[model samples]
Target: MRIAVTSASGKLGASIIKHLIKKIGNQNIVGIARTPEKANHLGVEIRQGDYNNRHDFDKALQGIDAVLLVSGMDDPQKRIQQHRNVIAAAEQNGVKKIVYTSIVGNDSETAFSPVVKSNRQTEKDVQEYGMQWVIGRNGIYIEPDLEYIENYVKEGGIRNCAGDGKCAYTSREELGYAYAQMLLDEGNNGQIYNLVGEAISQAELAALINQVYHTNLTYEAVSVEVYEKERKEALGDFLGTIIAGIYEGINIGANDVHSDFAKAAGRAHKTPLEMVQEIKAQE
Candidate 1:
């Protein structure tokens, strides 16, 4: 089966492309993105197309049997429309199956979770198209912590508003592997998989970071506003604001906890402790 992965420039998308190349051979794979130049190293047939362009998608899906639609990173509003275009094009082109990388608990109205709502709308569109699809409801990735881990170690503490709420953050690589497996193996069509990993609280994460650096570690539960201030000082206004928004959503249970990931992959996922150890061992 010919497989095409959208958003080939992204970390997770690139990983999935690589995995597909190994599973089905490079020649049978296709990579689609707005900027095909960025994905030149993918070693697959690159199709240049924007999510908004239905014409481009028609050409891209010519011989593709399945598509892994990596949700766009643009504004949530635009992403919803773009997803609709892809769904329409896929139906017109007769793509057999589709796998969407969506977010967990997207059907509910949670705190500041625009992606959740947007994904829900897109999922509905896919279902309406009468296509065989699998939704991988991936949780927050643990790799984002790499930016703050050193600072947390240096300050000997980390502050967040999640309090004692637990979160099951998945590794991007693991998620990519799971998506590859899903594409290769059938029987999961129409199933929604909530991908989660080891559960870890902010305090537990602090302890793990401390152990990694052999330093004293602590977690300070603070309000969203206060954390925003600190994050802005460290990460600048724009990015800091975005991170603060995500964490604020976490505090209110938008991303608090879940365990359905193991069910999707049919096995246990990675844990925070293991991730911390790996990070420490790296230079």
Candidate 2:
């Protein structure tokens, strides 16, 4: 089957394409990106696939048997229609199967709700489409924390509004493997899987970081308002509020959900310790 992955220039999209190449070979994979040149290094047939442009997808998805729709990063309201453009184009092009990468979040509370709601709408659209479909609600990615280790070290600890709530974190690599399986395996059709790893509290994450990086960093829980203010000061108004909202959801236990990683990927999700160890090995 010929599989097309949208947003192929992105990290998550690229990771999924990498795994797909291993499973099906580059000849059978298509990389769809808004800037096709940016994805040339992926060594697949690159097509221009701007989510806002139905004409682009009309040509891009032509002759493709299946598609992987990576959720868009535009404003939540705008992205709903953008996603539809791709879905409609896929149908027009006679694509047979579609897989969407959704997210796990509190739909009622938090600044992140709009994004979640948008994805939910797209999920509904894909399910109602005249084709086979599978959806995966991804957990919070742990890479940001690992990437921010330098800043955390300088700050002497990690400070957030998560309190004692646990977060089910997964990595792009893990999500990539699962998405590849979802695209190729018909058994996952019509299934919505919560792709998450082991849940752990902020304090536990700090301890793991300490063990892996050999640092004496601590986790301090702060008030939501205070954390929001600090994040705003550091990251500006828009992104800061969104980041704060994610932590607020965590504080409310929205991120601690049952994981279907094993069912989705046909294997167990990697442990947090193993993830950190892999990073250390890479360093």
Candidate 3:
């Protein structure tokens, strides 16, 4: 099948393309990026497909049998409009299928409630189109913890307002592999796959990190305001707001989900502990 991956220069998009190239030859793949030059190394047909540009999508999606619509990264309303444009462009271009990268628990209101609501709308549009489609609800990525780790380690603990809440964290690579399989395999049309790894609590995660780093680590439960303040102090306004919302999401039990990601990937998903060990070794 001739396939195209949108946002090809991104981490998840790049990972998806890397694994997809292994299954389908490079000639059959189209790398759609806002800046095509960065994606040239993928050795696939490059197209300028800006999420904000309908004309770009219309041209880029032509001749593609299946397209992986990676979700937009910014303001909720604009992101949804961009997604709608892609859906429209795909339909107009005679694209047969769409595999969307959505978020876990997207049907509920959470820290990213607006984005979740928009994603739900996009999912409705895709399903209502009566076209071949697949939805991959990706789990929270563990990579962001790398930024917060130094603080946690220095303080001998991590502070959060999540109480006993847990997150089903997975790596971008694992989610990418799952998407690749969904794109390459034919029988999974009209399905929703929750691409999550394991639900692990903050205390459990801290202990695992301690085991790997040889440092005494723990979770220091704090008030929401304190957590927000600390995160704002560390990550600045933009990322701080996002990370604070994540804690709120954790508190609201948003990321607490379960799924057969291992079965979908045809192997065990990487654990957070394993990621900690890998990070520790690098340091």
Question: What Cα-based lDDT does every candidate model obtain?
Answer: 0.79, 0.95, 0.81
Model 1 bad stretches (over 4 Å): 105-111, 154-156, 213-215, 229-241, 278-283
Runs of candidate 3 exceeding 4 Å displacement: 106-109, 232-239, 275-283
Order the numbered candidates by lDDT, best leading.
2, 3, 1
| Candidate that beats the other on TM-score, 2 or 3, i.e. the better one | 2
Q: After TM-score superposition, what is the CA distance of residue 78 in candidate 3 from its true location, in Å? A: 0.9
Task: Pick the lDDT winner.
Answer: 2
TM-score of each: 0.89, 0.99, 0.90
Instruction: Evaluate model 2: give its TM-score.
Output: 0.99
| CA error at residue 166 for candidate 2, angstroms | 0.3
Per-residue lDDT of candidate 1, residues 35-98 (tens digit): 9999998898999879988788988888888999998877778998898878888888899889
- RMSD for each model, in Å, please? 2.4, 0.8, 2.3
> Which RMSD does model 3 reach against the true structure?
2.3
Q: After superposition, how far is residue 31 of candidate 3 from its true place, in Å?
A: 1.2
- lDDT tens per residue, model 3, 210-240: 7876667788788777877877898886666
CA error at residue 236 for candidate 1, angstroms: 7.0
